[model samples]
Target chain A: MQALSFEQAPPPSVPIRFFLTAPLFMLLAGLLLLIDGEAVMASRWTPAALALTHLMTAGFMLQVMLGALFQLMPVAAGANLWRPSVLALPVHLLSAIGAVLLVAAFHHQIAWAYQLAVVAIGCSVLAFVPAGMLALSRPPGTSHSLIALRIALLAFFATVLAGATMALARAGLIDTGWLRFSSSHVALGLAGWGCVLVAAVGYLVVPMFQLTPAYPRWFARSFAPLMVLAIGLGMVVLHPTAWLPLIGLVALFASVTLDRQQRRRRAKLDATFRFWRFAMGCVLFACAGSVLMIFNIGGNAVALAVGVLAILGGFVSVISGMLYKIVPFILWLYLQPRVQGVPPMTRMLNEQWVLWHLRAHVAMIGAALLATLWWPAVYLVGSLMVVSAALLGGQLLRVVGRARAALRLAQPS
Target chain B: MTDRLPPIVVDARRLLPPEPMERTLEALDEMQPGQEVLLMIPRQPAPLFDMLHNNGYAYTVESQPDGVFHITIRQASGD
Candidate 1:
C-alpha cells in the first residue's frame, strides 16, 4: 500500500499571535462594561450593549477560534493553510482593528468608524474565510473534524455577510430591510459558526487530551450537517421558533460531551476539564432558557438571561479551558527541538494560575448571570470579568515568555 | 544499541499531537540496523510517513477495526 503523508502545521508563531491578542479584547470588553454599566443593562439593542456583545463575539471568540483553526487544519485535518504566516499577519491585524472600530462605531455612532470597520473587517473575513475553505476543499484524509470545520467555515461566511448587511443598514447606506436580518445573523453566528466549531474541536480534543474514548461515529458524523440544515431552515423562516431544533442539537452535543468526559480513563481531573464540564452545564441551561423564551413562557428577561449564559458561561468557559491546554502544549511542542531540556507541557504554565483563573472565571459567569437578572449587579460583573480576563491573559503571556526564554537559552553563543 | 533487540514499542494512543509525532521520530533516530519501531496510535501518522520515506525508511501500517493504527518502521536495506 502507498504510504500516508500529510502537511505539517504552521510555525507556532502564527497561532500564538492570535492567541496573545484575544485576551486584550476580553479586557476591553470588561472595561467597556465598567464604563457603560447602566447603559449596557438598559436594553440589548442599545448601542453600548451591541458594542459589548460584539467585543465578546467577534473580538474575543473569533480570534481564539481562528488561532485554533490554524493549528488544527494541518495537525488534525491534514490540510495545509496557504502560507499561513504571511496570510495571518494581515488577517490578524485587520480583524483586531475592525473589531475595535466596529465597537467604537456603536459606542459613539460615528459614520466614519462604521465605514472603516466595514472595510477592515470585510477584508479580514474575505482573506480568512476563503483561505480556510480552500484548505478544506480537498483534505488529505476525511474525518468528522474536517467535515465540521468545513461546515463551520461556510456558516462563518454567512454570518459575516449578514453582519455586514446589518452594519450597512445601521450606517444608513442600506434600507431597513437588512435590519430584519438581525435574528438570522445571531443564529448564524452563535449556532452555525460558534457552536459548530466548538463541537468540531471538541470531537478531536475531548478524546485526545482527556484520554476519553472516541465520540460515537454516528454522532460525530451527523452533528454538523444537521446543525447546518437547522440553521438554513431558521434563516429562511426568519422566526425565533425555527431555531428550536438547532438549540436542541447543541444541547445534545453538550450532553454527549459531558458523558464522554465522565468516562475518561484518566482519573486526575484538572482545571481545564472542570472548565469544559462547567461550560457543558451552561450550554444545557442556555438551551432550556431558549426553549422557554421561544414558547413565549418568558419575556425579554428570559432572553437576556439565556444570552448571558450562552455567551459568557458557555463560550467563554470553553475557550478559556482550551487556551489553558492548547497554549502550553504549543509552547512545549515548539520548544522541544530547540532546547536541550524542555519541560513537560504541563510545566509551561503555572497550574495554580490556571486554577485561580478558573475560580475567577466561575465567579465572573455567576456575576454576569446575576447582572442579567438585576442591573445593580453589573458593577460586580464588570469587576470580576476584568479580573478573569487579566488572569487568563497573564497566564498565556507567562507561558509564551517561558517558551521564548527557553529558545534564547538554546541559541548558539 | 544491539541489532538483535526487539522492536521498541511506542504507545501513543492516549497522547495528543506532537507527542505521538515526537516519540515516533525519536524512536526512528535511535533505531539500530535490523531494529524496528512499533507505533500504536489512535490516528494515521500521515505526516510521519512522508518524513520516513524521504529518509529512506520502510514502514507498514495496519488499521484496526476499532480505529487504532499500528505502524512499524525500519531502516531501508543499506547505508
Candidate 2:
C-alpha cells in the first residue's frame, strides 16, 4: 500500500502588502484629525486629536513597524518566525478592531472607545512583545538596523503601557499621572518606538538599497537611549529640571548627524534624501526653539507648538518618506517577483514609481508643518496627506494582487 | 544528451546571500564562464528560478519529491 503526499505552497509577499497599506490608512486618519487643527492642538477637541493621532501612531505607524519586524527579525536574528502564518489573522483583527474602536470612541464622543482602544492596543502589544522578543532572540546578525530595533523594542513596549495607562485614566479607572505617564507615553511612542525603530530600519535599509555605509555604530547606539534617559531623569529625578534641555540637545545632535550621514551616502541621492533633509530641518529647528523656550524666550503655546510640530510634522514626515522607498522595496522583494522573479524582488517594481511617492510625502510634510503654524493650511495639508496615503496604499494593493497571481502560477493546480 | 548530464545538486540555499532568492541571483551573474552550478533550494526557492529565467538566464528546473528543488545553471559565456 502506497500513499501520496501533497506539498504546501506559500505566497511570499501578502504580509508586506498589508504593512504598506495599513500606514496609508493611518495617514488618511491623521489628515481627518487635522481638519479641525487649532481646536485639536489646543485640546479643545481631544477626541479628534486622540483618535486621529493614534490612527497615525498605532494604525499607520505601528502597523508597519510590527509587520516589518516579522519580516526582518527572521533574517536579523537568524531564526525563523514562530507561528508566522498562524499569527497574522488574530494579530491583524485585534489590532484593527481595537484601533478603530478606540479612535471612533475618541473622535465620535463614544466613551467606550477609550476602553475598546485599551483592550485592542493591549492585545496588539501582547502579540507584538512576544513576536519581537522571539525575533530578536537569535544572535544579532550584522545588520545595525536590527540591533537598533532590538533595543528600541523595549522603548516601544514602554509607550504601549503608557498608552494603556492613559486609556484607563481617561476611563476613570485609575488616578495619578504616574509620573506624567500621558506625556511620557507620547515621548516614548515618538522617540522610542517611532523614532528609534524608524532610525534602526533607516540605518539598514538606507545602506542596503542605496549602497551607503552604516552610521558609526556607537553613535547610533548611544543616540536614542541618551535622549530617553535624559527624558526619564527629567520626569523622575526632579534634581534634573535641566535634563529636558539636555534631552533636546541630544535629540538635535542625533538629527544633525543623521542629516550629515544621509548627505554623505553614495546612493541614488533621490527624493528620499530630500525628504530626509526636510524632516531633519523640522526637528533641528524645533529643538533649537525648545532650548530658547527653556530660557523663557517664546510664549508657552508657541514653544509647545514647535516641539509638537517637530514630532508630528518633522519626524512623521521623515518616516512617511522613508516608507515610500522601503514599503516598495520590501514588497518588490517579497511580492513583485511573483508578479514578474528572475529579477525577483530586486527590480520587481519601478524605482521611478517609488520616487513619485517620495516626492509627494515630502510635499505633504511641508504642507503639514505649514498647517501647524497657519489654520487654513490645515485643509490643504489634510488633502495632501490623503493623497499620499492613497498613492502608497494603491501601490501596495497592486503588489498583493501580483502575489496572488504568482501563487496561482506556482501552485500548479 | 539530457540523460547523460550529471545531476547538479549543491545546497546553495545557505550560500545565497541573505535576501530574496532573486537578488541572490545577482551574485551568480558574476560567475565565470564554464562554471557548472547545482543549487539545492527549499521549494520556496522556485520563485528565484522563475525570476532568473525571466531575466533570460539559461536554467533547467527539476523537482525531487523530497522537496529539494534542483536548479542547474549553464554559465553565460559573455558573447
Candidate 3:
C-alpha cells in the first residue's frame, strides 16, 4: 500500500484556479452560438460549429479534467505530483490560451492561429503527460482507478498528438493524410481519454459521494482496457460497423452506472446525484444515435444529435455536477481548521443557485437537441447555455468569496 | 496504583468524508491527556493523518479483515 501524503496536497489555488476559469470557456461557447446560430446548427463541419465544439471540449472540459487530476491523483491514488502548485501555472495558462487560439483558428481559418495553437497546446500536453505518467507509474497500490488513470493519461497523449497532426495538416504545414484519421482522433479523445478518465474518477467518486456500493471488481478492473481495445479496433477496421463494439461498451458503462445509482444509500437526491442520472440517460440516448449512424438512418442530422447528447448533454452536465461537490468540499477542507466558523461543505454554496443552474442546463440540453433537428431553436439553446454557464460561474465565485470572507475574519488585527 | 482511561472508540465506518474526519477531531479535542482514540473508518484517512501529525498527535493504522481501517491516535508525550 502506498502511504497517503495529504501533506503534499497542493494549495487550494492550484485546482481552484482551473475550476474558476473553466466556465468562461463555456460562456464563450454560448456567445459563439448566439453569434453564428444558423451556420453552427446547419452542420458539424461549419467553421462556427467547429469553434463551438472546441470551446466546450478543449476549453472547458480540459481545464476541469486537468485540475481534478492535480487534486485527485495525490489524495485518492497516493500518486503525489512533483510540486503541483508550480506545475499548474504553465498548464493552465497554455491550455486556456491554446484553446482560444484553436477556436479562432477554426472560426476564422487563420493559418497562423492554427500553427500557434498547435504549438501551445502541444507544449501544454507535453508538460502535463510526463508529470502525470511519472506520478502514476509507481502509485502505492494498483487500484482499479489508478490503472484506468494510467491508461487514460496514455490516451490523452495519443489524442493530443493526433489533434496536433490534424491541426498541422490543416495549416498546410504537412500533408501526410492525417485528416483521414478524424474519426480516430474523435474516438481517442471522447472514448479513450474522456470516457476512460470519467470511468477512472467514477470508480472513486461515485461510491464516495453518492454513498453507493463500490463498482463490481471485475467491471472496474476491465472497463478502461476494454474501451481502449474497442477504440483501437475501430481505428484499424476503418468501417462504420466497427463502432458497434465501442458503442456497446459505452452503453454498458452507462447502464451499469444507472443500475448502481438506483441503489444509492443516501436518502437525499441532491443536485449532483440528479445530474449524474440525467447525464447517464443522455449517454444511453447518444448510444441510440450512434446506432442510427451505423445504419445510415438520419445522416448528418443524426450525427449532430449524437454530438449534442454526448458532449453538451452528457459530459457537460456531469462535469458541472461534479464541480458543485468538488469545489465546495475543497473549500470546506481548506477552511475547516483555519476558519473559526467554516460552513459544512454542503452549505458552502447557495443551493438555490445550483438548482437554478441545473434547471437551465437541462433546458439547454433539450433546446440543443431540438436545434439539431430544427435549426431555429439554436437561439433558445444559446440563451439557456449562457444562463447555465453564468449561474455555475456565479456560484463558484460565491463559494470562493465565502472562503475569502472567512479567512479575513480569522486574521489578527 | 495507576488507573488508565480506555481509548475512546469512534466508529465512522458508516459515515462519509468530512463527517468521519470531523468526528475524529471532535473526539481528539475532548480527549484527556494520556488518553487515545481508536477511529474506525471505511478507508485509510490519509488527510487526517497529516492533521494529527501537524497537531502533535501520533497514530498507527491497521487494516481490518472486513475492509475497514482502524486508526489509533494519541497526543504525543511532550505535547
Candidate 4:
C-alpha cells in the first residue's frame, strides 16, 4: 500500500471557503431569475436562460465539488495534494471570477466578457487539473472511488476545454465549428464531470455516512468508465438516440443509490437523507423528461423542465445535503483536539434551520417545475430559490461561527 | 519477565469517522509503556497513522481479505 499522510490534509479553511462561497452563486442565480423570469422561462436558448444555467452549473456546482475534492482526496483516497491551502486560493478566486464574467457575457452578449471569462476559467482549470492528477497519480489503494475520481478529473478537463473553446467562439475570437458542439459540451460537463464525480465520492460517503451496504462492486467498478464511453459516443453520433444510453446510465445510478439508501441502517432520517431521496426522485423524473425530448414528444418547454430537474432539483439538492454533513464534520474534527468542549458534529448547526431550508428547497423545486408550464410561477420559483440559498448560506456561517467561538475559548489569554 | 502487556484491541469497524480516530487516540492515552493497540477498522485509517507517527508512535497496518484493516500501534522506542 502507498504510504498515506493525514498530515497532508489541508487546513479546514481550504474547503470551507469554497463551500461557503457556493451558495452566494445560487443566490445570484435566484436574483437573476427574479429580474428576468419571463425571458429565462421562455426558452433554453435565451441569453438570460443561459446565464442562469451557468450560474448554477459553473458557479455553484463547481465550487462545492472542487472544495470537496480538496478534502476528500486526502481523507478518503489517501491522495496527498501538495499544499492544498495554497492551491485553493487561485483556483477559488479565478473560478468565481470566471463564472461571474461568463454569466455577464451570456446575459449582455459582451465580446470582451466572453474572452476574459474563457481566459480566467481556463487558467483555473489548468491550475487544478494538473495538481489533482499529480495527487491521484499514486493513491494509497486502487479503490473504485480513486479510479472514478481519476476519470472524473479527466472528464472535468475535457469539459472545461470544450467550454473554453465555445466561449472563445462566442466571443468571435476564433471562427470555428466548435459552437456546433454545444450538445457535446453539455454532455461532457453534466454527465462526464458532474455525475461521475458525484458517483466517485458517493462510493465512499454513501456507505460511510448512511450506513448502507457498499455499492455493488461490479457496478462501482464499471460506472465511471461506462459513463465516459457513453458521453464519447454521444459526442460522436450527434444524435438524440445516442443520448438515450447516457440517460439510461444516469437513471441506473440514481436508482441504485436510492436502493442502497433504502437499506440504510440509520434510525434518524436527517435533512441530508431526505435531501438525497428528493434528488434521486428528481433524477428519475429528469431522465423521463429527457426520453420525452429525445422522442420529440414535447417542445422546448420539456427541455427546460429537464434542465430544471437535473441541475436545480437533482444536483443542487444533493450538493447542499452533502455540505451539511461535510462542513460540520470538518469543523468538529478541527476543533476536537484544540478545544475543551467541542460540540458533536450533529449539533454544530441547528437541525431546525436545516429542516426549514429543506422545506424552502422542496418548494422551490416545485415552483420551478410549474414555472415550465406557467410562466407566472417563475416569480415564486425565483423567490423560493433566494430563500433557500439564504437559508443554506446562513447555516454554513452558523457552523463556522460556532467553530470560531469554540476556538477562541480554548485560546490562552 | 517481560514488561510488555497484551495489545488492547479496539474494534472500530462499525464506528463512524472521527470516532475511530478518537477511540484510537484515547486508547493510546491510557496505554502503559510498551503496550500496543490493535485497531480493527473497516477501511485503512490513513489519517490516524499520521497522527500516530507525529506523536512518536510506531504502527504496522495489515489489510485482511475481507477488507478490514488491522493496525498495530505502539509508542516508539525512547518516547
Candidate 5:
C-alpha cells in the first residue's frame, strides 16, 4: 500500500477559490457601500441605502459563510460528501451572479437585474438543499457543528426568500413594506441565519483552534431557542416595540452569557480570545442600538448603527481571528505531510499576523461606527477596514502558496 | 536465500475500538478443534505471556525489527 500523501488530491475546486476570495470582495463592496452612503446623505448620489446593506450581507457575509460551511462540514461531520467538486462549481457561479445582480438592480434601479438575481439565488439554494439534507440525515455521532449548520441553512433559505420578495417589491412586482417585508428580511438574514451560524461555528472553531474545552452545554443549548425567538418576535413586531425589546433581551442575554463562558477558558489569552470578546462587545452594542431604533428613540440611524455593529464589528472580528488559525492549519494540513516533523502549522504562521489584522479590523470598525455619528468620515473608517480586510485575505492566500511550494519539493522524480 | 514478501492486508478502522486486544486469549478460547489463527498487530496492547498464563493457549509473538508484529495463535485452552 502507498503511504498517505496529502498533495495527491487535485487542487480544491472553484467553490473553494470563490470562498477564499470572498473577504476581498467584501472589502470592495464595503468601500462602495460607504461611498454610496456618503453620496446618499450629501445628495451627490441618489442611493437606495439598501444597496449598502446587500453589499455587506450578500456580497461579504453570505459568500464567505456558504463556502466555509461546504468545506468544514464534511471534515467535522465525517460526512465525506461523494461529489463536493460537482456541487461547488455551479453553486459559486450562481450565487456570485445573484449577489452581483441584486446589488446592481437595487443600487441602479434596474428591474431586469432584480429578476435575474432572484432566479439565480433561488436556484443556488435549491442545489444546496439535497446535499445539506443528505449530510444532516446521517446517523448520530456527527459533530454538533454540522447539526447547527443544517438548521442555519434552513434559516438562510428563509432569509433569501424574504429578501428576494422584498427586491421584487422594489421592482414594483409587489406592493410591500408597511407589510413589514424589509424588517422580516433583516431579522432572518442577520439575526436568524448569520447570528446562529456565527455562534455555532464559534463553538467548534474556538475550541478546536484555541485548545479551549467545549462550550458549556447551557450556552450551546440556549443558542437555538434565543435565535429563533429573536427572528420570530422581530417578525411579529415589524418595528421597534415592547415585543422587539424582548427579542433584544434574549439576544443580549445570550451574547453576554456566551462571552462569560468564553472568558472562563483558561488558555493563557490570545488574540483570538480578544476577537471573541470584541464580537460580544459588538453584539451588546447592536442589541442596544436595535432596541433604541425600535423605540424610535434615535431615528433610522440606529438600524445603520446596528448593521455596522453586527457585520463589521461582530462577524469581522470573529472571522479574522479564526483565519489566524484556519489559514495556518490548512497550510500545515496540506504541507506538513511532506515536511514530516519540521514545524507544526501554527508555527508556520504566528500570532503577530492575527494581532496585526485585529488592530486593523478594530480600527476600521471604530471608523465605521464613527461614520454613523459624523457621516462624513465614512471612507476614512472604511479605508481602514478595507485595507485591513485585504491584508488578512492576502495572508491566507500566501499560506496556500506556501503549501503548494512544499508539495512540489516532495514529489518523486 | 532472498525471498519476496506478500503484501499484508489490514482493516485500519476495525483496529481502533475494543482496546486491550488479546490474541492468545481469544484463540485458545475459540479455536475450532486443532485449528490455528494467525494474528497481525502493529503492537500488542496486552502482554502475550500473561495472556497465555491466564488462558494456556498455544501461541508465539514474533516481534519484527520494523513496527509490525506477527503472532501464531492455536487452540490450547477452553473448548
Candidate 6:
C-alpha cells in the first residue's frame, strides 16, 4: 500500500486570505452594476455587461474556488500541496489584481489594462496550475472527488489560457477571431472548471455536513469525467444542442444534492442548508432555461438569464453557504488549543447575519433574472448585491476579529 | 529474547488532531525490540498505518462495537 499523510492542513491564514478578499470583489461588481445599469442590461456583448460578468465569475467565484481547492485537496484526496502558504500568497495577489484589471480592460477597452491583466493572470495560472497538478498527481487513492478535482484543475488551466488569449485579442495584439472561442471558453470555465469542482466538493461536504448518505459511488465516479468528455466533444462537434446533456448532468447532480439535504440526520435547518437547497433549485431552473435557449425558443435575454442563474444562483449561493460553515469551523479548529476557553464553532457567527445574507442573496438572484428582461430591475439587483456582499463580508470579518481577540487573551502579557 | 514485555498504551480518543497521531508516532519511535504500542482511537488512523507499514512496522486493528478502534503496532520481526 502507498504511504499517505492526511495531517498536512496548512495554517488558516492561507485560505482565509482568499475567503476574506472574495466578497469585496462582489461588492465592486455590485457598484459597477449600479453605475452602468442600463448599459449592462442592453446586451451580453456590451462592455459593461462583459465586465460585470467577469467580475462575478473570475473575480468572486474564482477567488472562492481557488481558496477551497487549496483547503480541500489535502483533506479530500490526501494530496498535500508543498509549501501552500508560500505558493498561495503571490498567486492570490496576482489573481485578484488580474481579475480587477481584466474587468477594467473590458469596461474601458484599455490596451494597458488588458496587457497587465494578461501578465498578472498568466503568472497566477503559471504558479497555481503546476502546484495543483503536482498535488493531484500523488494522491494515495483514486477517490471520485480526487478524479473530479483533477478534471477541474485541467479545465481551469485551459480556461485561463483561453481567457488570456481573448484578452490579448481585445488588446489588438492578436486578430479578431479569438472572440469566436467565447462559447467554448464559457463551457470550459463554467461547466468544466466550475461544475466539476462544485460536484467534487459537494460529494465530500454534503455527507459530512448533514450526516446524509454518501453520493452513490458509481454516479460520483462517472459524472465529472463524462461531463468533461461531453464538453470537449461539444466544442469539437459545434452542434447546436450538443451541450444540453452536460446541463442535464448538472441538473441531475443538483437533484441528488437537494434530496440528500431532505434526508439529513440533523433535523434543525441552518442557513447553510437553505442556501445549498436554493442553489440546487436554481441549477435545475437554469437547466430548463438552457434547454429552451438551445432549442431557439427564447431570445438573448433568456440566454443571459441562464448565465445569471448558473453564476449567481448556483455558484455564489453554494460558495456563500459554505463560507458560513467553513470560516467558523477553521477558526474553531485552529483556536481550540491556543485559547483556554474558546467559543464553540457554532457560536463563531450569529445565525441572524447568515439568514439576512441568504434573504438578500435570493432577492439578488431573482432581481438579476428579472433584469435580464426588464432593464429597470437592475436597481434591485445592484442594491441586493451590495447588501448580500456586505452581510457576508461583515460576518466573516467579525469571526476573524473574534479569533484574534481570543488569541490575544490566550497570550501571557 | 522471548521475555514478555508490556505494550505501551496511548489513548487518543480524548485528544484532538496532530496530538493523537503525534504521540502515537512518538511511542512508535521509542519502541524497543519485541515491544509493541497499542492505541485507542475513535477512528482508524488510516494515514499512520501506511507510514508504519512502509517503515517496516506491522500493525493490527480491532474495531469495537462502541466504535472505538484498538490498534497495535510493532517493528516487524527481525527488523
Per-candidate interface DockQ score: 0.31, 0.08, 0.37, 0.28, 0.03, 0.09
Chain B TM-score against the true chain B, each candidate? 0.87, 0.53, 0.92, 0.90, 0.52, 0.88
lDDT of 4 by residue, A150-248 (tens): 988998899888888888888988976878878888888889989999998888777766667789989998999999889988888867899998999
RMSD of each: 3.3, 9.1, 2.7, 3.4, 11.2, 6.4
Worst 10 residues of 6 chain B by lDDT: B13-22
Docking class of 5: incorrect
| Model 3 stretches with alpha carbons more than 4 Å out | A1-5, B1-16, B31-41, B56-79
- Candidate 6 per-residue lDDT, tens place, A84-197, comes to 989999889999999999999999999999999989989998999899999999966788888999999999999988888888999999997997888888989988999899
lDDT of 5 by residue, A1-413 (tens): 00112222223443346557677666766577556657533321244456656766787677778766665665454444447678777777888789888878977988888889999988988897667668766736534555566668788888888878877877778886533576677767776777778766766565444544456676666666667775677677545573474456446544654555464434466777788778778878887787777667876456667777877787777666666665555455444324533244544554677678788878877777777678877767667767776777777776666666666667755
TM-score of each: 0.89, 0.74, 0.92, 0.89, 0.75, 0.85
Error of 3 at A133 (Å): 1.4
lDDT tens digits by residue: candidate 2, B1-79: 3334353345643332225354345446555555545676534353455556566567776777754457777654432
Model 2: residues with Cα > 4 Å off, grouped in runs: A1-14, A30-35, A41-45, A140-147, A176-179, A224-228, A239-267, A292-297, A300-312, A331-356, A406-412, B1-79
Provide the lDDT at A141 for model 2: 57
Worst 10 residues of 4 chain A by lDDT: A1-10
Candidate 2 global CA lDDT score: 0.59
CA lDDT, every model vs. true structure:
0.85, 0.59, 0.87, 0.87, 0.63, 0.85
* Model 6 TM: 0.85
Interface C-alpha RMSD after superposing true interface residues, each candidate, one decimal: 5.7, 13.4, 3.3, 4.1, 15.3, 8.1
The TM-score leader among the candidates is: 3
Best by DockQ: 3
Interface RMSD score of candidate 5: 15.3
Output the TM-score of candidate 2. Answer: 0.74
**Model with the higher TM-score, candidate 5 or 6:** 6
